[model samples]
Target: MLHQQVFKLALLSNALLLSIGILQNPSLVQATPSYKASNSGVPTQSARLNDTLIIPGLRFGPITRTTTYQDLVKMFGASRLSDHDVFGAEGLSRLPGTKVNLGETRSFLVAWTNNSRTEVAEVRTTGSAWKTQQGIGVGTTLTELQRILGEFEIPGFGWDYGDVVRPKQGRKFKYNIPILYLSIDLKAAKRYPSDYRAVQGETTILSSDAHLKHLGIKVGEVRVYFDQPGMTSAE
Candidate 1:
């Protein structure tokens, strides 16, 4: 009878341990990051690599005529920027310029090239696959993702931002994970030759990438995909 009691106690202890583990591992008991992102949080790091991938870009408007962040403020008066990075560089394309700096001004210029045309893309990330995955809870929402991640990296696109990312949810899927879609709109730019708009656009993308790569050891490559309106005035 004593032996039987010990065996039963052992079983109870094992059961208790299992319960504790499940409770500790929120993902196992609750939802996965992917699931949470789909439901309400940002996309998980895994979704970017293992699932359909797309980098986020900014939904830009004509700011070319405006030369400085101050100029932007004059027109916008604290208007909302589409949470994304507007940047560019030279080494990759051999453009006769240096590195692009987004932080130079809250509002900066972005250039891209289309068949000898130069233009810029306001890059944004919907949600990057984390350098590693994180636990997710059941009631995760976009607001929650913003709280935890604060910022995200886009895939194959040379842009990212802290504020622009918004979370969305849709129909459920196999893993019961919702699909999270984020926008990566290249800012809309209009041409004005007579006005002579001269804002200092970012010089190089390399520096920004370096910063992110350092920020997250396992983060992936950074590249910008933009529309080229036409080449800048040749030097």
Candidate 2:
């Protein structure tokens, strides 16, 4: 009987010791798993969508008037951005710029104010992905533009500054102006000899011109310029 009592006391002591140890170190107990998500350093889908947005006179995705070449490298990585000479407006001369996405369908150009490339002068995209708030993008037809812009003018085709959309005087736009410029090119211009002849050259063609409606002219490029005072476009 005494041996049995001693054995019972030993068992109780062991249980008490275990309880004491657990009390002293509460971490000994299993804790509820906390599932914390970590970022893999890749941009999220929403972030990429924001980057593709073309906010006129303000931002092109993450790029702004103050965005630098180094900023481009950081945002898109050096592999996606490459040095290239982009043709200036009016085809005056080639200016230093960075080509984004290289040969991809999402390819775009960022022209700098100078060789320093410290400031963004313009952001041009032929890619259909970059679009304004009004859904006007590279592939938007001339008729669609007229419907949206409300009586805009188109420069004649077959020249350096040809096919550019110029807003008419006293015309009000749904959005702000002097920032977004669209270049409309008619790929089938050659097919319509009479229509092409009527609109080709350095003349200004009204958006409502009967010849232009059937020509199937579409916006080939979207250029966003930063040229206001205290802005980046100046030399």
Candidate 3:
């Protein structure tokens, strides 16, 4: 019985010592910095290209020309602009699209015209990063574009913008309608692989593989513009 009493006293003494130690140094009971768990609850990265189609008479992804600068930052996350960065500048392109800076030397210019206080007029790009809902974008071969858009007219200047396509046939108000205008880099298309050269245009009749190689045959850009009679210009 004496030995059992001594064993009980030792167990109680250990519990009391532990409680006193915790009371004197409360931090010891607290979670350690390294042992503490956390969750950011947000994505650290995003897609490389916006991939949002520049739909005419509609919306460009989730934004438009009138999307305020603050909303733009909120939607696309705050831009990591540089000291020399030129945002919404005109020198970027011949059109009036405002450049929205996406960090790391990438951007898309949102332009407007017709003094239409509504949707964005045009979305232009010189890069091959972005794409449309139809999977058309820069680096798409003329043959691929033909397969996608179907029955488009070639521009007078050869592989360039100003190539217009009607949404429908025979309309008196067609002149005032909005048409799809493709902006292409003729020089880049001309340099595409031999297979891409097989695509034929209205003026260029491909008789042989060699002739096809010499034809300008790739889509380097795409634009949706409103036919504003004497207002639209090619770059």
Candidate 4:
């Protein structure tokens, strides 16, 4: 048992070393590897959030919950997806729901559990206005996001949409919540199959301290998605 643990530690250390090397080089993480980006916020495998996806400048204005492709064309002027297969992906779908301020909300997100290859995605099924904590214009609709992102997907556990809330300083809802994901499923040859489940009663953490007022949860609500990874990168 002791030898097994030592071997595991060694393997972990090697992985950490590899990741550090990749980060320091920066070139290895560049989108297109040898090409510059065509637009802003459209991250390739190389482009990563310097801070976090939840960074302050990343929020947009909120529109009605029922957004569509025409809204994206009007706002972005062109489409980046340029493909049909991406639309069929489960990672690209979000249920219809309005963005609201839950008022000092506290919640947690679980991406993977017990070595489960779970991931999260931000999908907008309709064209809606999204907002930030400061209530600035982020963008309108999912296609708008698609133009900015090109095409990509992340394996996730589930989402935390309804748990979001507005600030005490604002009277109306100021934040537009993008769909949150906890787990993701993938599709197979002619069919969608495969799933990743979250660790039951697993520990969780939050970036907000004032919202919790002092309590951090060791477990949280779990959601599931189906049909991811089963498809190749959009082409």
Candidate 5:
């Protein structure tokens, strides 16, 4: 009985020491319900937040105008984000931006208001996954855009701001919300030189232009600009 008691005490002591070690070193502790690791090894909570809805003129996932670089790093693992200089419209200037997922299909660019990267000036994405609540996104056809936007205007092609959508009057989205700048480009503008020529350079081409259907135009990129003071127009 004495020997059995000693063995039991030794086992209990070893278990206690192991528990204490785990408490002292958090890395050794098993994942709790609230702190589980995702398949990619990032914390599940952060990974989940990264998939938040993309609301135009509002938020991209959990990211907003107030979101910072560190906030992005927290939502998306640091390994997935890299800093780079994004060229302003027409290659006029270079602005600091964060490239998320880089070359991946879901990749997007977040341009900062300043070098500090504490304020997001805008978010641009060509990924179809990042769609507005109205289901507008990259790959949305001209007809589809017309259906959603209900008579918008696009800048003429073959220029810096070519193909960018603009509100005909004041911000006339069919939904009556702030504009989400979409760059819709013809799949093969060069194929139909006449059609291309008709829409090139500083001209405002109405979305209802009957000729646009033959050009195979689609939303190539989507940009959400935060309403920041001194914020210039979308390029």
Candidate 6:
């Protein structure tokens, strides 16, 4: 009986020691949450546009405005991409569109310069997950955008009748580029009569075209672009 009790005590002590060992293990104690992002305030790979800050001249998620196309490939792993030259600059500028996970954002466009593969000129995205620090995202309402971004202007033509807001601070004159593009869905315009009227008042085309007048209004997509050295007005 004594031997059996001693064996039982020894087994219990070993079990306790093993539990203590596990509790003291630094790896186990320091284990991080899988969902947390490496950079605080920076969004995770799966974070939505409004969930992260849109720091112009800085970065978006894992991609910085200055991050090169080659660097992107190295960071995100191999991705199928298409490359082209800037519309007017030709050889001077290279634009590469990559198919990578942009959370809820729809597109990822990067531009490089100096005829180099690693020179990143700009980064643009229409991802819904991409947003300004003010929480204005791709799907944010026009009223909300106007409220946060103040007055904005809409290009009279093009497939995107989105309004552009140039922020006065946080990356202003450093890059003479559109900070945020707020657009509405023409198809959904009829549903939002007030927004439809707002769009009509902003652009003459919508008001002039009787058929297009019926278009609806819902925040369409948002695009954020960085300014590079050689880019001209045509780009």
Specify the highest-lDDT model's number. Answer: 2
Residue-wise C-alpha lDDT for candidate 5, range 32-83, written one tens digit per residue: 2233555634345544444634544456655568888876776677998988
From the highest TM-score down, the ranking of the candidates is: 2, 5, 6, 3, 4, 1
Expressed as tens digits, the lDDT of each residue in 1-235 for candidate 2 is 4433543353344334334443554432222122221263333434543456565455666667787887666566788878888885456677799998845447889988899998888888878877665677788877787777778766577765556665554333444322333443446666767887898776777889888766777777777765431111110
Tell me the tens digit of each residue's lDDT in model 3 across 150-189.
4334322233222333221211211111233333355655
Better of 1 and 3 by lDDT: 3
Off by over 4 Å in 5: 1-52, 176-187, 228-235
Each prediction's whole-model lDDT (CA): 0.26, 0.61, 0.39, 0.24, 0.60, 0.43
What TM-score quantifies how close candidate 4 is to the native fold?
A: 0.20
- Compare the candidates by TM-score and give the number of the best one: 2
Model 2, residue 24: C-alpha shift (Å): 67
Window of ten residues with lowest summed lDDT in model 6: 226-235
What value does the lDDT take at residue 176 in candidate 1? 12
Error of 3 at 195 (Å): 16
Ten residues in sequence with the least summed lDDT for candidate 5: 226-235
Which runs in model 2 stand beyond 4 Å of their true positions?
Answer: 1-46, 89-93, 177-187, 229-235
Compared with the true structure, what per-residue lDDT tens digits does model 4 show for residues 1-235?
4433543353344334434443454432232222233353233323221211221111112111122333323323333222121221235542322222212221111122112222222122221122222222222222332333232222222332212111111111112222322221123211321212221122232223222212221112112112111111111
| lDDT for 157 (candidate 1) | 26
Give lDDT for model 2: 0.61
Quote the positional error of residue 169 for candidate 4 in Å: 24
Error of 3 at 201 (Å): 14
Q: In model 3, which runs have C-alpha deviations exceeding 4 angstroms?
A: 1-51, 77-97, 103-106, 112-119, 158-213, 225-235
Misplaced by over 4 Å in model 6 are 1-52, 80-107, 157-163, 166-178, 189-221, 228-235
What local lDDT does model 5 show for residue 224? 65
Local error of candidate 3 at residue 115 (angstroms): 11
